[model samples]
Target: MKKFLVLGVLFILPIVAYLFFASGVNNFAKLPVLTPAISDVTNFKSLSEENVSLEGKITVLSIYGDNVEGREGNAFNLNEKIYDKNYNFKDFQLVVIAQDGQQEQVKSLLNELSSTIDIKKWKFVFGSKEEIIKFYKSLDTNLKLDKHLSTSHAFIIDKNKSLRGRQENNNEEVRYGYDTSSVADLTNAMVDDVKVILAEYRLALKKYNKKEGLK
Candidate 1:
C-alpha cells in the first residue's frame, strides 16, 4: 500500500509541474518592457517651466533634415491624418529634433502646430542632445537607429516616449544614371517604420491606460 501511494504522488506532481511551466513559457518577454526613462531630457526649457515631462503623451520626433518650420507644412498634414481623418489623436504627440543651432526654425514650426485648427492635446518638442537622449535611452537596446539618424527622419515614440522607429540612412550613395541618390532605395524608409511603431504604441496605450482606468 505504501509503495503504490508513492508512485501515484510522483506521477501527479510531474504532470502539474509540466503544465504550470508550459503555460508561462513566454512570460520572459514581459520583463523586457521595463519602464520609461524620459527623466534624462535635460535641454528643454519647458521641463522646468511647465513642470512637465510629457509623461503621459506619445511623441513623434523628427530627427532629420531641417528645423521645425522647415517641416511644419508636412507635419500639419499628418495632424489631419491622425486627428480628423483617423481620430487617433487622443494620445498622439509630435516633436521635431532639428539641428542644434536652429531654434528660430523650431519656433516657427511650433507656431504652425499651434495655429492649426485641430491642434488639441498634441505636444511638440524640439531641442538638443541632452533633451533627446531621454527619448533614445527609453528604447530597447537592440532596436536599430538609422545611420542617417540626423535631425531629418521622424521618430515615433510611444506614450511611454520610448522610441520605436525612424528614418534609416544607408551610407552607400549610388547614382541612378545621374540622379546620385545616397543610401539604397530600401534604406531608412520612414513611413513603414513609423507605422510599425504606431501599432505597438497603440497596443501599449491600450494596455497601460486600461490598467490605469483611463478612457
Candidate 2:
C-alpha cells in the first residue's frame, strides 16, 4: 500500500506542475500587441495617385467623432506648419477616424482642408460610431470627446503605430476653441513630432545598415 501511494504522489506532482506552467504560457500568448500589418491601412487620396507605406515614417492619426466642431467634417491631417531645420520628420501619415453621423461633415472638412492645405500628405478615415467608441476602449486613451471631431481635442498616433500624444486647439489666443484656425497649429505639431521620431528611426536604421554590411 505504501509503495502504491508513493507512485500516485509522483504522478500527480508532475501533472500539476506541467498544468501550472501551461496556464501561465497560455495567458502570456493571449496578450494583445499592435503590429504594423494591423496598423497599415489604405491611404486617403482625393484622386487616383501614388500611395506609399509610411511604416518607418512617423504618422499621426486624426480621429473624428461627436466631439467635432460645428458638426463639420472631421479630418486627420499631417502637421506641415513647422519649418525648423532640426525638425526634419518628413514622412507623415494621418488616418481619420470618425463616426457615421459626422461622415458628411468629415468629407466636407476634408474638402475644405484640401483647398486650404496640401492635404495630399494626409490619410483620413472615418469609423462607425461603434468603432470610434471601441477604439477608445481598446486603447484606454484619455481623450475628452465632445461628440464631434472637427475640433482640436484630437488624438495623435506615433510612427511605431502607437498613440503618443494629444492636444486640443485650446489656445485662448486663438478664437473658436475648435475651427479651421486651429488646423494649421495642430497639423504643425504633428509634423514636428514626426520629424523628431523620424530622425531617431533614421539613426537606428543607419546603425543597422552598417551592421548588415559587415555581416
Candidate 3:
C-alpha cells in the first residue's frame, strides 16, 4: 500500500508541474528586467511647463522643427491611432520636441488636432535647436534629419528611459521603419510594440508587489 501511494504521488507531481508551466504563469514571472544605461534627455518643458521623465510612463518621441509644420502627415496619423487605442492616457504619452521659438506655432497646430481628439496627453517640449539636436543623436537612431527635422521615424522610450524598438539581428536601423508607403503595417507594428512595453511594465509592477509582500 505504501509503494502504490508513493508511485501515485510522483505521477501527480509531474502533471502539476507541467500544468503550471503550460498556463504561461512561469513565463510571465520570468520576464526580463530591462536595465538600459540611457538616461532621460528631455530637459525641455511642455506647453504647460511641466518637466518630463520616464519614471512611470511610456513615451513616443519626435523632434519637430520648422519643416514639421505642414509635413506632419505621419505624426498626425500616429497620434490618432494612439489616442483611439490608449483609453488610459496616463500609461502612454506622446512627446513632440521643438525648438524654443517654435512653441507658439507648434501649440497652434496641436490645438487644431485637439479639435478632433483629446490632446491632453500630447506634450510639446521646447529647447534650443542645437540642444535638441544633441538630444536626438543620443537615442542612437538611423533616421537622417534633413533641414526640416523631418524623418519618417519616431522612437519608443520605455518607463525606464530605455529605448524599445524592434531590430533584426543584422539590420542597420534599430527602429521599426515609418515609411508612408507601408503606413498600415508600420502603424500597427508601432502600436503593438507600445502595448507590449506597457504589458511588461504591468508585469514588473506585479512582481515587485509580490516580493514586497513576502518581505
- The C-alpha RMSD in Å for every predicted model, in order, reads 12.8, 17.6, 6.6
Model 3 ranges off by over 4 Å: 1-35, 39-42, 87-89, 169-173, 176-182, 213-215
Model 2: residues with Cα > 4 Å off, grouped in runs: 1-57, 66-91, 149-151, 165-192
Q: Rank the candidates by lDDT, best first.
A: 3, 2, 1
lDDT of 1 by residue, 103-202 (tens): 6665555566667555544443445654455555554343333433343234444556444432223853221111002123113343334444455556
Better of 1 and 3 by TM-score: 3
lDDT of 2 by residue, 1-215 (tens): 99999999998999999888655444432212232222443433322234544355455444555544453433422233432222234555555555555555555666866675565555545456556655555444443455453334444344555544333346633211122236565455544444444545565677799999999
lDDT of 3 at 148: 66
For model 1, what is the C-alpha lDDT against the true structure?
0.45
Candidate 3: tens digits of C-alpha lDDT, residues 26-116: 3543222233535564577677878776556777766676555754676667766655577474578877777777767886788778877
Q: TM-scores of all models?
A: 0.44, 0.51, 0.74
State the displacement of the C-alpha of residue 184, model 3, in Å, after optimal TM-score superposition.
Answer: 1.6
CA displacement after TM-score superposition, residue 188 of candidate 2 (Å): 10
Worst 10 residues of 3 by lDDT: 26-35
